[model samples]
Target: MEHVVLTVQSQNQLQQALQQLDSSWLNLPSGRVLAQVYSRNLESGWLLSVSAELRAKLPNITVVGCSAMGIVSAGSDWNNATVVSLLRFDKSSFVATLLQSSPDDEYLDGRNMAAELAIKQRDLQGVLLLSNPTKLATTRLLRGMSDELVNLPIFGGLAGDFSQKLSTSVMLDQALSDAGSVIVAFYGEALRIKTFNYLGWTPFGEGMTVTSTQGDVVKTIDNIAAYDLYNYFIGIEKTGFFSSAMEFPLMANHGGKLVARVPIAVGEAHELVFLAQLEPGDTVQFGYGDVNSILSDLSFARHDLISFGPEAILVFSCCCRQSFLQDDPRAEIQPFEDVAAVAGFFTYGEIDTANVPRDVLNATIVSVGFSEEPAPAAEEDDWLITERAEMKMSRNLNRLQRLMCFISRMTEKLNAKNQELTRLAQLDSLTGVLNRRAFEEQLAQEFQHCRMISAPLSLLKIDLDGFKQLNEDFGHAIGDQLLCNLVDIVNRCVRHTDGFARYESDCFMLLLPQLHYGEALVIAERIRAGVAQSLTIKGIPELPKVTCSIGVAKFHDEQDTLDALLSRVDFAISRAKSAGRNCVKGE
Candidate 1:
């Protein structure tokens, strides 16, 4: 009997709760068929305390899992509790593959991965897989898995923080190593897999066909490198060479799979980065995720509840997606509740049958809702009410909601405008850093105050590593996101009281107070770390990662005026850059 597939989760008291489950569930008939118990992580490794007991009993039955947002136990405010789900399968009815390993393998390798399922020789009912989807081209992984396995009906999702998918998957008990995965594949009879294809994103602009290209990394489209084509559409200069285009594309479920055609990104330089995911020869359409549209899609589904609902569902949503209109998921829960009684955490990526029947893609959310009993017929009460009386009663509430949303939008716009104005006044607009005037004012203010107080103050100067080469390689947009991300990182590491002003194009200065000379070295190291990290901006690829070097100097009342401090830091900074792209040194 396929009973309820309940995934109980909590982020509190993880150890105690697991003990209670071990004693109670280990012997229960519900778990005897195969109870795979797993604990959650606190963004780190799960404790051996939680694992030692479970591993003792089910030595052969492997459970590949990880934490749910935080360390947890059941009923621990959801965010503080641990999560454990029981899959009671009729061992006779289904051939399940529990692939577990260390950093190297979860339970099985690719060869065993294909063989384990093939042995089931069970009619390929469906593939319910879950793994870490970070950085890995899951689409490519499964394409290979299915090509060998042949026509496996795929369902399920990337099992990680769907809400925050930036981190890679953390399979339970697996070594916390990068580029590792824990794969779970299930095959059996008595299971009917029905797939519902939905990209949910709608296309916006005109369609552009690929005039030329290669594999996933497109070389050219319409006789131009994909990047050049995008530059033309968005008005980016081609002074530097580029690989791809600013791909603004909508997602579609054509031929029973999800594909992002013509992916696009808005770079920090106000230019576009092409995030092309489709083949170069394929035609592309521009699209984006509209929060309102997604909400509307949910409402529309309610009307056609006859389509894919009425049964309980497990929703696997893309982790990259931060719900827009219903950003406050709690407020919007009622809407989804009305649909499938959905109780699915966000997914790292979703696996859906792709272009071919049963081929899976890398980044997607898969929803699997099972009905314990036959669904009841729709009734009059179930029909949504457009009640005039209730409508009148809720008028004030509706008005207030609209007003609040309007105010929020206005606040965002105002902030954007203020940032622009500040940048224009204080920065070299072309370089997008503090201008010469702001720099002078800041330095003067810091110098005078620190001089009077006899406090320790430090100065820093920075220059991009190989900036000219940046201009020679990919164009200016790449240079722009790099700078923006760099500044953002520096801001994150610096104190609010500290000041950062760009003195020239590709040159920035940081002023730190209330610190001694050696302390300045520590701050300099942090600045170096912040600027040297790479972040992928949406809609662009082939953006060379960013690197920078910092030179630090301390203010001495005797030898240091504002100009002297700047010159020393500037010189030290120049030396740092010359040594290597990412370093911090002090004088």
Candidate 2:
């Protein structure tokens, strides 16, 4: 290999203007191959077909690529076509993994796939990855691969579309072709990998220490939910809890022009949902106040890259960032040619392995240039990666693990919160009982559990007799309040284990465990009596009276499931409805 050789720019046309450029020179045949392609968000079959054509040219390709945000067109908009940048060298040296749309078989093994690729590439140095930033978890993917490759380098960026809507990643291979990850191992000295990328942003204003954070949600800053810190920082005294506070650009020092020197968008939330990317214990303050200064710093990073000595390079950057420097992104890299450089298209998310002590978490980039010369493997050092991450965090990453714990625990609480919701789904929204679906499913489960325990299960079908008359006479709001108040009354009378669902608009089904026939009737009558008395909502002072008619039935060994029990109780409830309003009847 020449001290700096092989500059390949393969640009093929899909429809009109050619759209693609894959340039790689240094690791000619390594253990891994990174194949990425980006297309317009709404582009059609012809576009997908065109990409497949070029991908077919490569051997042993494991496909994983996503859409791109406005492709850099030397100052022109290139929205109609997709760009595919292929970087490959050496076979059997890299490992690629695909997470696709299918449940794995119990016998499925990933190690086997990796081993096969390793058998071909032999001396694997690192891993190259490509994934859709959309459906797939880019964050999770990188974290997972960091473990698998452990101390090995990983690099690539998210597929993007300027629209930021739904997009696809092409996973091209002769055997399996679809939208998923495909990992292949390379054998030997085909590629050289190292990185010179940084967050390239900074912190500004007075810093606020992250007090309490859970995942991306900051419960408090300065001991208040992080929103207050955001509001205080952004100078938003009114509606301090609003989402805008979080969305505002937050600045931190990754320690100079190397990481960030100003404005980087942080987190925020609105409505009842929280939306933020920052964890607690981080020191953040307002940023973007000086947009021009920030742009100057960004431009300087690219201008500085030519000094690194790359014969040719490709850039992957953040789409959220495009709008900020849309004025002239190419101007920053124009200096690349001044230093042994030929370059090509840029991307939404970029990835490169960083040698952080004992680990390598692939760093995403705003702009990174690859040099094919004997660059002496600056990537071999471990400290550079850690320094960059800590700098990116503004040296406030010490509490990230604790913050992740907070997020994990909170997630558990939210997942288990839907018991009441499940109950209401089966019942009428206003009624305080089983909804039809829940009643049925629970009836089956309770029946089975009781069958195992050899206990009795009672089913009561109840309806508000002449309830529609009240709705007609008293307006629906009063009727609704009547139903709500009625539930509170009924809940107290039922056993803790007993459940209920709304059977329909004016009807409900209650399951009473360990209750005999008489007990069921007594419970039913209690509901009837409670409803006869009118109740007031906490805010509303007036409401007309309402009552219910109840019907009851029981389960026996002879009966198989809940269906018959419901049928019998519904029949009895119908009889009560016919005979009189506000009464209990059973069969």
Candidate 3:
């Protein structure tokens, strides 16, 4: 099979492109011509004339066309221009159909189209879908198509308009549409198709939970107003949030893979609006994309196609990436020109039914490479050399890249070492609670804050009862296991905001920041009862139930020192030990 691409600058040049096709591929046995026309504000009637002209010129070949933001042919930008790619398949059987979707029946339309196509062509290997995304739900359309043919790999993008007026149009054969889709299925024994989807956004900061959502709008994230978080991260009001949020998209783990949810608008309640519906309580990480990482990802995609030896490379890159790259989208597309003919358009959202569980992706690049045979290593090596040579860089950019690499590695190693050191310094080695030093440091901070705000702060001192006798009877190993079990029970009883520490052997301290003496006494009693009820020593029937003596102390005014508070709590624990060891006392 052979393919030829013609780039036309204007309506006057349109005839020239068709003439090039006639001179080169006029008499091919079976072929298909796909045209991506640049739509100007000139007129809609011109489309009919252009379709008629293509039909007259290539009557035997199937002609499918669409309006695009910018036309790309062989990985070169040809905006305000038309790009036509003619593929002549020798052994493949091709079938093209146009299905119009009603406003309410887009899903049903997709199912019907797939079912009809399945009946017509039973040997299909894959499908190419081009849809008008202005009014139709493209995700539902893809779902319908998948329902009928689950194994078929579908690849294509939503049609686009030059002026962003939502005037995207699609054409199948001689028919045109502004609110429907066209499905083209290819079936044969000789065709081999491979697809790759790339998203290079790196997640930063902690993940936020989707606490509340309504349809495509997220009302609350982490219990804060979604728009408030949006404003905080984007550093802009609702008016500019949409444009500014393009750089940082929300990444959610869906279908076991990270998929981006690009924020498109602000809802009525100032909620962050997404292209896809998000369920409540889904964890999403917000992050930014790197330019170097984007290029690196595209380079890897190129390598995959090179290895596959594809004859044609079709790309459906998100419009966000195009705007991000601006004048340099060629950096993403041009790499594949050496290995295959490239044809693609920037899309609103990408549809990838090829994945094990189908997903509609946003802020991502989806690629499909078609080949009959694998490419050679020598040609791939030559392409690599050419690629490096063409990547002419300024001195500052080179230095900046090197510096970024060095800083990235250094930062990574520093973070890892810092985390290990912090873990060792802050946590008890025997039982994973806070060590005494860390607890005291934290206590000092909490104490000062409570004194300044006059908020309640309480402390608990706990000692396991009958420790020396039990150790002598059950041995030190059993005593150690029993201590560990007591720690677990205490941890389960305390609030997450409260801090617990191994004050010393057989003694533990608990700090409650927003609780008074009465609340602290209640928690101490609960811990006392929980340990007595749940703590068990295996294989030692001689031992009685494990219990603890507890003490509770509330922080007084600024005159009350941290040492004075500790002394009061320690004395209370002594009283508890004297008054029948397994009880709680407060002072």
Identify the leading candidate in terms of lDDT.
3
Which lDDT tens digits does candidate 1 get at residues 1-587? 23222234332443344455433334433223332233334435443334444455435334445433221111224443334444444432333343443432422354456656666565655555655544444445555456656665555555453233335454444344234444545544444344443444544444566655433345565555666555566554544322122123434444644465432233333333322245544665544444433444445444444343435444555433323222332322344444554444444345655224433332233445443233456767566634211111134435544654565466557767867776678766554556768977877887888888888888878777777787678778876766676677777777878778767666778778777878878877877766665544556666566677788898888456877886788778777867765898776
Error (Å) of candidate 2 at residue 328 is 1.3
What ranking emerges by lDDT with the best candidate at the front?
Answer: 3, 1, 2
Indicate which candidate wins on TM-score: 3
Q: Where does candidate 3 stray beyond 4 Å?
A: 22-24, 27-49, 75-77, 223-225, 237-243, 372-431, 434-463, 466-587
- TM-score of candidate 2 relative to the true fold: 0.46
lDDT of 2 by residue, 371-446 (tens): 3345533444422322111111212232533444464456446545655555455565556465677667777888
| Residue 145 in model 3: lDDT | 85
Error of 2 at 461 (Å): 76
Q: Rank the candidates by TM-score, best first.
A: 3, 1, 2
Look at candidate 1 and tell me the lDDT of residue 64: 43
Tell me how candidate 3 scores on lDDT: 0.74
Model 3 residue 363 CA deviation in Å? 2.1
Candidate 2 deviant stretches above 4 angstroms: 1-12, 15-35, 55-64, 72-75, 86-97, 101-122, 166-170, 173-187, 211-248, 251-277, 289-311, 338-350, 355-587
Model 2 clashes, total count: 76
